[model samples]
Target: MENLTATNLYSFYGKSPVLQGVSFDLKPGEFLSVLGRNGVGKTTLLKSIMGLTDRCEGDLKFGETDLLKCSTPQRSLKGIAYIPQGREIIPRFTVRENILMGTFARPDGKRDIPDYLFDMFPILREFISRRGGDLSGGQQQQLAIARALAMDPKILILDEPTEGIQPNIVKQIEDAIIQLNRERGLGVILVEQNVPFARAASDRFLVLDKGRVVLNGTSAELTDSVVEEHLTF
Candidate 1:
């Protein structure tokens, strides 16, 4: 496990900046939730960490290494797995093939999916030969998570993992994420609109407004008043 630290970070797309002077740190094995209304740069913050932004300024360090010097693949190889919005699984690829792609980031050069991933999302095992596009939205979300786990990441970064899924699957995904953090000891950075889940699952939380962090504290500090003031539209 490693600590991910961002200091005075600024991220931009072309000439427009999405993250402005943001600073935070995720301790080893800590579960941190990023909360905000839409378009508040919550997604951009995760992208910046993954080196996906067009340009970034300031320092992003994973453990003792400087992350700004690393490429997207380098970030992945370092054990930071990002499951972005839209659950971007390959539409034409089979479930097994999609999962194998994650192994490309493994430093050990192993290309096999872990059996635990299958146990977490049995639908993926059942649809192992099915094209990724053939799965329902909820199933695709599970596939996305399974694919990320195939890499055996130390830190899992997720953007709205439960959005638009069926209620039953939503509970399953939530339970899985909690299990990953609490039981498996993986560091987690989650960007979510679900305040209830965020509050329940996170050890700490940050509230973003516009492109800056307006409020942040331990999960116990994330109250209804804070959500109504910052998160509720």
Candidate 2:
């Protein structure tokens, strides 16, 4: 497994800076959570890592590979899978087809959907022929995650996997994410508004404000007082 490192990173969109001097690291197989209020650049930080930002400056490395020059597809091929907010699955594609789309990032040129994906989200298997748009919000999120896993990523970056989903499905998604990290040993970077889950699941946590990292530390250090000060609105 490879480690992800960012140093003094700056991300911009059309000359407007969104992430200013943001820096952090995700050790191989580690789980990191990002917490911030609305529009504080949590999503921008992830986009910068995937090369989706309009511009970026400073060093970003995955293991020994410099990521600054890698295109989004190149980064995906290198085993970085991003599940952005909104669970953007191809609405017209069937559940199986949406999962297969992730195979395009595989360096081996194989297109088989992993059996484990269906195992992780059984609802997906039950609705294998259903179009993505026809699924409920929670099911669509599951499909999005299944699609990401089909890439066989070394690291998974997710923006609010449980956001705006049904209450019961939220636990399922959270459990799946934890299982992927703890049992499957996938490195994970999560942006979450659920402070309790973030505190419980993360090996480390970062608190952002105004597009900058105002606080970061090991999970144990993310005390309730810290949450109140940095995370509570």
Q: Model 1 segments beyond 4 Å from truth? A: none
- Per-residue lDDT of 193 in model 1: 88
lDDT of each: 0.94, 0.94
Where does candidate 2 clash, by residue pair? none
Give one digit per residue, the lDDT tens place, for model 2 in 25-81: 999889999998898999999999999989999899998899998999999999999
lDDT of 1 by residue, 28-142 (tens): 8899999999989999999999999899999999998899999999999999999999999999999999999999989999998999998999889999999999999999999
Q: Candidate 2 — what's its lDDT?
A: 0.94
By summed lDDT, which 10 consecutive residues of candidate 2 come out lowest? 224-233
TM-score of 2: 0.98
